[model samples]
Target: MHEMMKAIATAALLLATAMPALAAPAPVYDERPAKLADATGVRDYERRAVEIPMRDGVKLHTVILIPKGAKGAAMLLTRTPYSADELTGHGSSAHMGIAIDGYDSAPDVVAAGGYIRVIQDVRGKYGSKGGYVMNRPFVGTSLNPTKVDHSTDTWDTIDWLVKNVPESNGRVGILGISYDGFTSLAALVNPHPALKVAVPMNPMVDGWRGDDWFHNGAFREYNLTYIWEQVATHDNASHYELPEADAYTHYMRYGSVGALASAHGLDQIGFWQKIKAHPAYDSFWQEQAMDRILAKAPLKVPTMLVHSLWDQEDIYGVPAVWKAMKPADKDGMLFLTMGPWFHGQEIERADSLGPVHWDSDTGKWWRRNVLAPFLAHYLYDKPMDVATVTAFQSGENRWQKLSGWPEKASSAKLYLHADQSLGFAPSDKEAALDYVSDPANPVSFMPRPNKQVGYEGNPWPTWLTSDQRPVSGRPDVLAFTGPVLDKPVAVGGDPVVHLTASTSGTDSDWVVKLIDVYPDEVPMDQAMGGYELPVTMDIFRGRYRESLSQPKALTPNVPLKYTFALPPVNHVFLPGHRIMVQVQSSWFPLYDRNPQTFVPSIFEAKPADYVKANQKVSVGGTEGSYIDLPLVSAPPAE
Candidate 1:
């Protein structure tokens, strides 16, 4: 029986193995291809991506957009560290207007004028193949012995565009805001023959002198995240996640910017390290100052310098570049346009900022009447008429056409008097106002619940125009109000601050703000009632008072004269409005904490270096604090 069972099992196993295994169920299949085909025939513009070879053989990623069927159209090129693909591909639409929309596109201008729009990624950024350098030094400079700079790259890009793009008219115009604006200005160093016009809006002329990184020796700590995001990776893939919602709390926790940066792995960033190495305005910064470098050569291109009156980021750039290039504008090639906008608000919605509203869409009007015509004049050879200096006068909300900037104004001194008052006359008796500035609890630059510094989803752009009432009452901030004005007081140029102040500590910082205080009742805008609107304001680090290039410790408790010029202003203090000046020792988070105690480098200051100090501002005597206002003559009848 056992033998019979074994024989049956062996026969069954042999039969199963011999029989063909039942065919496995047909495998489920996905018919879709591994990659989807590129979308075609739905766009109004032909988008082409190309690698333009620079002088050094590095190919820069460039995005070119030509209107369908466009012929002999001029090219508008913008070279930026910001991604060209992101800037040009803002939206996907059949209409060219919708496809090209971003910081520099000016969709309406590009479409109506039928121009080829080109956006190129600067070297070492995005698709560009090279190592990145922050505002790369000019060729032949000690900092950069390399032959390739922004100028050479721009020339190569323009040359490629003119030669390769059959739709282009051979003429090119360049315009951009902020860093793009810097590149626009750089293109003018040794401009390409194809480059006809250039417009640099709110450009960074100098990093260490009131542009981005430092303002008169005070480090702009708020831009540390910008440094990390921009310089940490070739494609800007790195992002800084804020540990705290309130930037004030986030910055205070670290004690110093250097500490905060180190904690976030920013030590690996070369620019941040370079910034730390040169805390003071030294040769490193002086050589990269675009304004100074451009001043050495004659203005080669027809350029228009656009400035935002309340430009939070680049308040000092346009003025500096204008001042430097004005002398070299031998052929009337340089123009200045100052608007009542934020950093880049000229390209965005500009009817209002915060609660302040202009009567009309000022940005649209400027673009149509000023920018478009200026571009057309050179690009399409269209006859155009624009003011040499076009300034939008605030308060009255009117545009002013002038022959030149800072237009022939008389100087008037606005003095700080007793009882927190401001007036044209000096105080008879010597008096002083005191406030304690503690780095531990420093004055917030913007209102509390401060978000990280950025354009979108942040108040950074309009913070300069925000009501100053929130900070006026702070113990660390001293508010001095002037009597109500019976008539209009037009200030048309830069306001100079003459401060006679002393600090209890060996080092300090001084922030002076020129404000316009509204009356108790505003019939038009109730939100603006009693608003302390800052007109022009800036900060100065006390250590650099003697010289920006050198740092010297202040004599404790001794009065020292601190003088610096605020940004240019074109606003009028209308009747019933009062002039105000607020002083403070710290504008924290926006600028790094001064530490109060002197240190070799504020960036490397220890926690113990930060101390509370009594700050005093003289309100009387010949050495009293006052603002030199460049008062203009009566305005033209509207």
Candidate 2:
């Protein structure tokens, strides 16, 4: 009986081995939808995707949207590094308004005007075929030896559209926000004959000088994620995963931004390496500064530069470009539009920002009146009158049409006086205020539980408009408060800061903020009472105080003059409101901390380099500090 049972077990095992191991249970199907549902009857606009060949023999992926039954429609083009497919086809709907809604496209302007909308992915990004360079240098420049640049690609794209698109007129207008805005500005360099108008809204004109990459000489460390995600892949498939909920803590975990980037393998990225190699504002940054480039290049096309008052990303760009291009506007081809919005808020809803609210929809009004009319006039040859400068005056909550920007304003000096007082007149005696700047315990740029830099699910866009009370009370921050205004103090154009300061260490960072303090009580919004709103502010690295290209160590403990300009401000200090200025050594995570001890490169600074230093600011007398306000008279009632 035992022999028979053994024989049966052996036979069963043999059969199981010969049965292909149960056939591996057949691979599980993905089950999730592979593609979106077809939009046959629901489709409103005709969509076409094609690869337009560049002069360098690289093809760029482009998506064109022609309104149904359109005839002789003007083409509105937007060249972007962000995907063209994602920008044009965000949603499926019968109405073009719902289908095309994103960062670059304005639904109201496009659908209402019956434009042939076109969006193209720049070379080496998304569907484009070529090597990608961040802010690709001009074709003849040393950085870009290739025959292709954003300008050439734009010229080729416009040339193709004018010849190929059957439902469009020969005239083409280019417009975009942010990076796309930068591309629009690029098109103005040797613009195509068909490209009649260009609008660069909140564009990044310079990366190193008070733009995306750095503010003055201080590195904008928060942009590390942007470089990581953008340059890691051609399609931007990689995303940055935050290690902690609080960005401040996450950044502080590593001694320096360079150390943090190295841990994340960002040293492999070309741009990251370039940033490390070029710590100072050398030829690398100077050659690519669009403001400087366009100043020499011909300005043939009618261009409109849009600036957001509280633009956190590119606050210095539009103003810098506008100032550079102003002298070249011999044909009266340049225009400026300043809005009371955050970065790219003009393309979105701009009725309110943070604690401030406009009674009407400011975005809608600007789009319908200023933007649309300007495009129509140039693209369709429509009879529409637009001003050279359309500025949105904050506090007053009204739009002003001026003959030109900076509007012939008078100058007034707001002196930092003794006893933490700010007045129009200087104090009789010299007074100095002292504060301790500890790099280990740096001041936070915003409130705690801080989110990473992004538009969605983050306070990055509106953080500039947030209340400043949190940092004003810190011991390291010195606040100078002026008396409440009995009458309105109107300010236009830029506010310049002339600071006489000294630091115990060899290297330091100076942060100056011009704030508008609301009244103690408010009838409209109780929450807004006593709110401290930063009107214009900036940071300067002391190492580059004398020369941007050359870094020099400071004469420690000696008072030195540090003069810099805050961003342009068009604000009204209403009756009962106070004007305040806050000075600090660090605006952490927003800008990397300065190692008090001088180092060849702050990026390579060791942990020991970070030391606490005593900082002093001269208030009055021979070596006094003050802010130069561009004072203008109040506009007439509408």
Candidate 3:
């Protein structure tokens, strides 16, 4: 009887060994609804919080997740100035984890061979101990590592993580969006040996030139509400009370930025005070600029940059870095992906931006195909067909992977005519359009009754695609419209505006907006027709025409030409849609009004210095004002 039982057991073992092991089921792709819920398989892991000590002995608050028994898993790290408290502890909502939303958009990184996920509070933030420096500059070749910046802190954190974390594969990658994205960039300046890949999505590169803080040397005072919120929330992990309900009314009442610090007790806000002190692109701003510093200390890690055409803030960061890194990218590791979404929409929602819809959930496709695979390649030696540039061209509503950006592009000139006409051919007769721009009655960047005050509370998810009807007929704005298009004119690269104009005052501003005029015979519910959607726009301070550091007064009524570029556009004017261009001097409560009369600096300009100015857009016989578009072929027939 014993011999027979042994024989049966041996036979059963042989049969089990002969059968092949089934492959793990493919990761489920969740349809990202408006309200996200807990993921199906992501919670089968162990999560805990730890205090990781940096080189300087400052302990940074960190939350980490590891699969129940995950072994040889690569580490994915994201450090943010924002709170990472939601990532760990009891009864935490899986969907509420910002890092999970950013990386595991599929909501199942665990099912895809789980990684060791980590989120850390940067130095001087939330649970971290030490002083925080915004956009902390990289410290090069430090003899005593105790005296460190963001880069060294990241390196020290990574060292501790790889050593302490159980079953880690000793490989690391970093990624984040917005300020977190800026931290990812800070990591690349001096990367650890384990750091392999990085994706700095819409990084905050330059505040002084064209990001959130300034545009062409103009201080973005209204946008400062975001800074105030950051200061309040980062340390205490709580929301700050706005002094007033209406930001526009409150800020306008304050009169000047300096008043915020002096009268409003905003001097406690260190960054705001620093911003007021440095009005120009001075040494202070240069020291914090990521692009300038990266150029000096060229990055060696493989990086995948992602951005959007309508990223209201930080739109200038990626472009500046793209231009600066092209020469130093000897390893061909620099890659770029641009879409028609707004801000961080490339990660959060790429299916449609505001009212603009795409053929697929571009955001999902990007995560499942582009973003996920790219990170996996460097981390796990997975194969990837990496493109130099992967841009989603709107109007065509298709994704195009190209060898390079602005690839073999041709320029088409759209001339601004006297009769408010926009056409390819310049007007033979010289003409000009004039408008009175008053600082007291400045044009509202957004429609009135804008109750959305601060960046944290504003209903600005789709402000980039808002209709221009609000500002269309304003006396301070000049609209130049083109005839209905018989065929779609697709623009591929950066659009440049060459204006021949004169201002009545020594100091003024030039604001250019590119709009897409919808046909008036579409769905009423969707408001599809006659919708004047702004595609791209930029502001230029007239005084900074010569140099960003030096201010020059405009020669009054001299018709001096000002040539500047707008944020790049990746869209087409569909057939039957008319292209429109609007020129104005002020996009108020958006940009602080530029005093028409030059002062030593606008920050110190009194209410009396605010003066009205007459601005003109001129057409010379041959050298007329025009917009040069990077024209490309229309989409292939359906």
Candidate 4:
């Protein structure tokens, strides 16, 4: 059996390596159909790579694309940690220069008719001077420009672009997705007069609460590639190339996250050290919380917050930042646009996410009607028709223009009943469903055939909406499913998982998955019969439930309520479909496993610390566990 397992693992690894390695999503560029400058006029555009001097004397590598008639045109800027060379090649259009996964053209630049597009490598990243600090805290109330940070770097970069660039109208607009989005937020903290508009899509606002690094105090193990390779390394963004081709096998061989660095001799990397040092939410992470930093000073510039329903990385931070940067008027400066797409998918191909289709090319629609007009209105003083908040309703396959996001959703509880069933009313009799969680055999985040190159790779972009049928019947995963729905139930905003459970061990990890179970029957070619689609999910390190900064061990077999959010969702459980809540203790490879035995830090745990945790989820009259969904009535009959 042991030899067979080894052979199987080796076979998987060889299969993965035999095929070409899938690349991560590329930097987003405008993918609009028409050209601002025609083929004849395209020859007139000039591209130049220059190092712009910042306040601290650190020069940032910048690429400027100026159209022939762009003398008085607005300046559209995107400051990114990604290489500027990749975003804009010598004199090529933004779309043509970079090979991106999804088609996202620079809508703001395209709609401005003819404009100066600037792409700059942020400090210490790819051809730029100065050390790169991840989500560098905003330097507050400091008059000295020498005491610089990301915000000041942005301020200095913009100051130089407007003054030095020729025939400048002096109006500047900044926008980006992911890390670039974070830089865009940094620009708002200390905005120059020329900075007129900012749009940050899926920006990293809080690393601790919900973002790439951590989710509710649980370390996101799968994203270690992002930290160790991409941001923490030298000027050039690096990637973790697996010798084994199977990341799961490679990670399992490492045993622990600390082992990955220590064995590899990578302690010198500043960000890697920082990640290991702060296992819990501490002052280090608190300082990097840009959302809290921005809360102190409201945004003065017109801003738009864009997010996808399936944004795997930074969904939590977007709405949080929007609320903090509150615009008093509903239809004013602060606005939100959400679509049923994955992270960066809104900018890419928005025809579908995984097997689920939104019934429209959402990316094209948003750029043409939503983002383009908003940018044009601000930059070119063009007439615009924009929504205060626009959200794409999933099951119904339509868009909703609301007064504001998640339109005053009402709460409804779905209780876990005795017979592994789900319902509204709590059961009068007490019952408990038990499962044994062995750290040795953790639940897979995605279905089998989950090798790196085959199913999904590192930075699993679309895994947020991946099918969940594989683990639905796993022995270690306790699933409480509802009956076939007679009517469609629309869930908007955040959903809270109220779990009353106990573990035989001192420490545990809790993962909650909200699923939309398709009917058992479907078309022959569809092959989606009884597919379990995860709408939203989240994990909680049990020790930090009381206080993220301070972790406490649980008394053995003591039943307690574990309430945590499954982030937010905007989906409908269509009639004939079923709603399911899967409770499990581990989602391996994606997250580091809990030792079950209490330890100061799981990162520092010995191999002996690993143990089986028999978990019991209670469902009854007094101790009934349920998920409170932000349910809303269907759109009023057309």
Candidate 5:
């Protein structure tokens, strides 16, 4: 009987040995809606508060989260100047409805992933102790010193996260959108040893030039959201009440975009105040812009940058930043992703899944694939298959992978022609058209701030600033349309403006727009829809025409070939749709009023000197001038 029992035991052991032993299967995480409530699998989270020490001596308030039963894991850090109490602590939780509707917070995402999550309030907002001075941003420049700013603050924060957070495999990554996105970018500037990756979406970089805040040069003073933030809240974080920010928040919200200021009883916002304070492109704006600093802030690790094609706030910033990164940093490491959405549309609009065709939720994929694996391999001994760059083209509605941006060998040039038309023709004689740009009622190619007052929030019900149409047909605006296309022609690239013409006045501005005429029969929306559909727009204040950092006044009619680089765009001109360019003098309060008299600087211009000037956009011979478009095609369609 003993021998038989032994034989049976031996057989059972052999069978068990044949079956492979599973190594705990990565500890399943509760990612689904229902599973979020599964405390057995979700709870046991570890949380703590610490004042992250920065190089500048300002202690930033932070909250660290460690997944239960999952140590020795990698870390993901999200730092914000908003409110570390909320972002890093308990306030950003679902109970506050800031992080999610019926879901958890970013900390929850990291906690569930069995990783370490660190949230820090940037130097001067919320529980963190410091002055909230976000109006200023950093670009790599010798003229500007390394202050206790977003970039430096970021470096210090990462230094602390990698060192203090226990079980943090030393490797760290950063993530945030909008203002927080700016903070994420800051960390990448001279990254620390453990900071492995960064993702900055709709980031607040160059606020003076292209941000929604200060278009051309005018102040979007009535931007309602920030107006409420400034008027009701004002340098105080206690009033960051989200639901109250909703228009339904107290009827203070106006009817349309234009009525918010009067409704809120505020004539101006601080953002506008800052613009008004600095009339010249001086240090006030230069130090705040990122273009000057991106190059010096080399990429130490793999970085993913994202922006919304329609991100009213930073529409032009994403591509600009991508192009600004030096070629050496282009180690197939700088990845870019553009979507059809706007700033914060992902969480704000309830879209965890990626855009229409991408299928995977961008943030999730970014985290799991790029960010997570980076941390794992460098910190926790894991491996991954990742990509360097990926961009989403809206018109095409598809994602395309590229080793580098400005992709290989794609070029085509469309020139400005006669009449209110657009095409590939050379200089012609169809006669120049004109328009009257009344200071009180200026024509616009793109919408400006409305009474609600901040970034593209034009107060009036006007067609998102499309009145720029008459610019080509009016007496004040000069017309240089392109010829009709024989085949389907599309434009996809940086829009360049070259105006080899002069002005009748001493000081003025040169505004050029690349328009896509959607067949005169596209039908208007009855409201402000009949204006112009500007595919691309750029403007150069005559005084600053030669140098963005310098000033030069026109000698009156002394042809000045001015160049203004419009933000890059990727648009397709189907058959029937025409490509047109409009040249004019003013974009007004949008780009601060140019003192038409060529004063020493935009600042020295006397209000009395604001005279009307005659600007010419002539073709042929000596006055030969035009706009150049970087046309692109390929990557096959998906």
Candidate 6:
């Protein structure tokens, strides 16, 4: 990879050379007709419902999809918390449906591409036996408990399928999205010999952090509608009731989210409620997070890691996991494609047909170029199709392959100068910025719809990376504004925050927001060419700064370094756009409020323990504070 940086630099310079024509007429891909619906014998693919037992005694319900009469063929496994039947609705009709035997889940799609497939329920969920725990679980106390977890169960299931199934090529690939995405990753942790390639999409890598429950540390805590409880348990994964859709409203701010929690009891968030019980990075969250004990994966075979840069959820988690692949030169074999869409919204486009425009499609691209060929090579000895790093460019509406992430661009840091400027040095001699975080009044960057509707759920992007101005007027929000740019500046990659000031009390929390300030206040209604919507915005919590493994309490007046990952993005900060970063001390119920007391758990702290603290964003010399951008230049606007 020695030539990587040079190749990237040359490519970036070439792209800059072509920026004049960079903006293309938005490329449109008409929703192509389903090829399998009309293909010969495609619908006749064999599928059977079966239950596979784990070493711990879980008889997980599954569906096996196989080409009629397939023999000794490699298997592709996809496990899901979502019913196997649900995935069929997600992909091309040919790949529709689920299976457990590792053969029937995707027999048609695999058969056309020529491989066997399997889809199964995770441990205790769906038709699978055993109790379920909401979210991926860590082993609980020693009383009677689950026989095995997602990892153990997956290993057991694959071992059995590779031997019992006739055309078993003895090799398997595990896959899924969202919940299944987590399961896909879970399977890879304690892998089976048969598990060859794994594609875990939009995986919930950070357990309770930002993956599913919390949004930038502030959770979307929709108590009534959350499905986690139903899918996670000690015996079975089934439907658990939500707090009630009526419980949430769009206009309710962080204060409201806090109130709702109080009404439900401390830590009303089921998983978080449980998390509060294990405040210090006890074994609980550790077991749920597989990234900590990653498997020895040179991956051995081809694999694709996919996620959306704007994936309202699961944003920061996947990319971090991608980079953690050990010995990239060895079994750490992996490729990544991050685009500008929320979760699986781009998989089939919400409308199912497209000259699609929601950033580049990683799903179809992978299924066609990567998945199809992978199966051929691993199962039938076919040659591989494309380069390693394939990614989607939102502004360009195109796919570009790279030797690595950020594709070759210089690493630069845009620091936070205490003088109110965002460049290298602060215009002020002052040491810090300070804001009080009264859990009763969390400074919000999210929008306010009607008081009765939820401004942040389901059909998101409505509140995503929207804007910092909503909370800009709050006394608690310390906004930092930068001068307008001379040319379009594109920022891509994770963002970090570093500081040198401490809390006045034992502990305090920090909240940061990155915003894209438009040349003019584009009203929400006119955002999408007359569609009312806010600008783009993102936030991050500060307590878990040093280590996600555990939360550390701050020492009074002690300065600390807090580096957290911001969601990835591919937005064009057009010339004249003012870029801004806001720093404060609270994001409220979305993230549990730090008690300012720096106690073991914020949840248990009383009101008197709360205290105010000063924050300092420095620049100059070694205090080297800044936001790093994966500033890779893309191909000229096509």
Instruction: Report the number of the highest-TM-score candidate.
Output: 1
Which pairs in model 4 have colliding backbones?
Answer: 29-104, 29-105, 29-106, 30-105, 30-106, 31-104, 31-105
lDDT of the structure predicted as candidate 3: 0.79
Highest lDDT: give the candidate number. Answer: 2
Q: Candidate 3 lDDT, tens digit per residue, 65-168? A: 77667899988888887666643443544432334554322344424646777889888888888876566655643212336887888899899998998778
Write down the RMSD of all candidates, one decimal each.
3.7, 5.1, 15.1, 14.9, 17.2, 21.4
TM-scores for every candidate against the unseen true structure: 0.95, 0.94, 0.88, 0.88, 0.72, 0.73
Positional deviation of residue 113's Cα in model 5 after best superposition, in angstroms: 4.5
The alpha-carbon root-mean-square deviation between model 5 and the true structure, to one decimal in Å, is 17.2
lDDT of 1 by residue, 209-266 (tens): 8999999999998898899999989988879878788888888898888899999999
Cα lDDT listed for each candidate: 0.90, 0.91, 0.79, 0.79, 0.57, 0.57
lDDT of 4 by residue, 80-131 (tens): 8777877665334443223122223353335345667788888888889887
Residue-level lDDT of model 6, residues 1-638, one tens digit each, is 86999999999999998987877676778788756354525654566678887786659888776766677777778776656544333444443232221222333345465566677776556667766666555434342165566778788888889877887778787766667777777776657777777777777777455676554444444432344344334333434333334322321322333444455443434554564565444466555555654543334544567776666667656776776673354643676666555665434432211222444345555556755675566556778755566666553445666666655665556667666667634333444566655655555434443122233453344345444456777777767777887766665555555555456666666665666666564434244321212223344444555665466656666666666656666555555567777777765333455556665545445565555544554444465356665565534432
lDDT tens per residue, model 2, 242-351:
87878889889898888989989899999999999998999999999999999998799999999999999999899999999998788999999999999999988989
Q: What's model 5's TM-score?
A: 0.72
lDDT for each residue of candidate 5 in 33-121, tens digit (9 for 90 to 100) = 85353233333556677887777677888877666665667777777655554453343332222222211134324543566766776
Which 10-residue span in candidate 4 carries the lowest summed lDDT? Answer: 96-105
Candidate ranking (lDDT, best to worst) = 2, 1, 3, 4, 6, 5
Error of 2 at 225 (Å): 0.5
